[model samples]
Target: MASNRIRKSALPGFRFSIGFTILYLSLIVLIPLAGLVVKTAGLTFPQFWETVTSQRVLASYRVSLLTALFAALVNVVFGLVVAWVLVRYRFPGKKIIDGLVDIPFALPTAVAGIALTSIYAPNGWIGRLLDPLGIKVSYTPLGITVALIFIGVPFVVRTVQPVLQELEAEMEESAALLGAYRWRTFRKVLLPELVPPLITGFALAFARGIGEYGSVVFISGNMPLKTEITPLLIITKLEQYEYSQATAIALVLLIISFALLLLINTLQRWTNRRLRSA
Candidate 1:
């Protein structure tokens, strides 16, 4: 009876489907990553170390990691606020504002760079006002942060927005009945439900910011050891035909990114488990 059930429930051509899935993954993901590893492996340990640890490369790493972290953190705060506002309230031009949230997803990175450059240049409208106060936005590290924030904001907003929309108001009402303050209620009730999505968004934004190029290039001024980013450094290596060096740096970034993402996933799981137990 068990054998008969198994035979009857089997998908037609399951073997072929499974084989194609494996082949497709190999062709699309594994093969390219393998090629990258192979190329990076061509370098000796000292060479790889030197390539990834050059003063310029180290500086780029600092800039990239810090700016990305800053951007992600900024997104976590403001994205939550934006998502909350959108989900809980009605306001003027609400539909237009909702549509605007997706602009980053549709806009080209290079175009974003150009547009930001134009708006934030010293002579530009906003820049002109800030320039007198001794603030520089374009062609600086701050500009890089702004560009990253621009592109990364959507990830956090979109991730948290749906979760916020699905959340019932009854929880807030219950907390209020229990004499909880507004902040306490949100912190205890809403935040736990939002934490998983928030972390996921932060990770996505952080990862994307690490590799961001076009949106940063125009604003960063590409000043090595100053405003340069790791992705730009990688591109420079490739342009100089230092293929092995580029691959080595890329490999290092890949490893670090993977480890960080894994750590985030572990933390998320732990948080979920604790929440469930509570």
Candidate 2:
């Protein structure tokens, strides 16, 4: 029996490692989420329903969701262009431009909000030009979308950059040799390879936009039923000591965000499978 003994794993720390992982997750993630659920559970079903579906709350939900969606979609288009430019071409000050792409990641959200508000306010530099054109950027839903776009751009750029870099330049050259136009080459040769990462980037940007707070707070003007976003509404509730109602709103947001992300991930998986099969 001693001679027949065998080791179960090549590494020795499995038990300790797994135990630590579970404990870390419970403390950092699971436990807090559980507390949120417990707090929200204090509300009766009808109360929770009315709290999350009130006219003001519903307006916030619409503003948050639609702005996030629009920002993510815009990022997908322009972020792809930015990634393509960084990867495909060499130009002067290229490094500076590339470094600037990460400014959002390093800049504080509050600073971003303040700076954006200043630049886009009614009497501010660019805003003065637009204001005369009857275009308002700050203190409106449009301003919220702009704030989200600023914060969310980096997510898309960073996510897609590596994938674009890994792509072979010769693929496009080969397509051109086969008589494909630039647009055709990109559509036929590059897009399939790029779709998965684009979806991932969209998901990341969209998720960030949804929970965004500081970056949006100043620009939005926080007008109830107009420029208000859900996260701000949650904060307002918490400030008023409406703990259960705040939790209920947060729970609804959490559930919807989770469902949307799950669907995006599923689509990504399906795309991967299709790519592999083809």
Q: Rate the local accuracy (lDDT) of all candidates.
A: 0.89, 0.90
**lDDT at 157, model 2:** 85
Give me the runs in candidate 1 sitting further than 4 Å from their true place: 1-9, 263-278
**Alpha-carbon error at 250 in model 2, in Å?**
0.2
lDDT of 1 by residue, 144-227 (tens): 999999999888998788778777789889999999999999999999889988988899889889988989999899899999
Among residues 3 or more apart in sequence or in different chains, the pairs in candidate 1 whose N, CA or C atoms overlap within 3 Å are none
Q: Candidate 1, TM-score vs. the true structure?
A: 0.90
Model 1: lDDT equals 0.89
lDDT of 2: 0.90
Error of 1 at 88 (Å): 0.7
* TM-score, every prediction: 0.90, 0.90
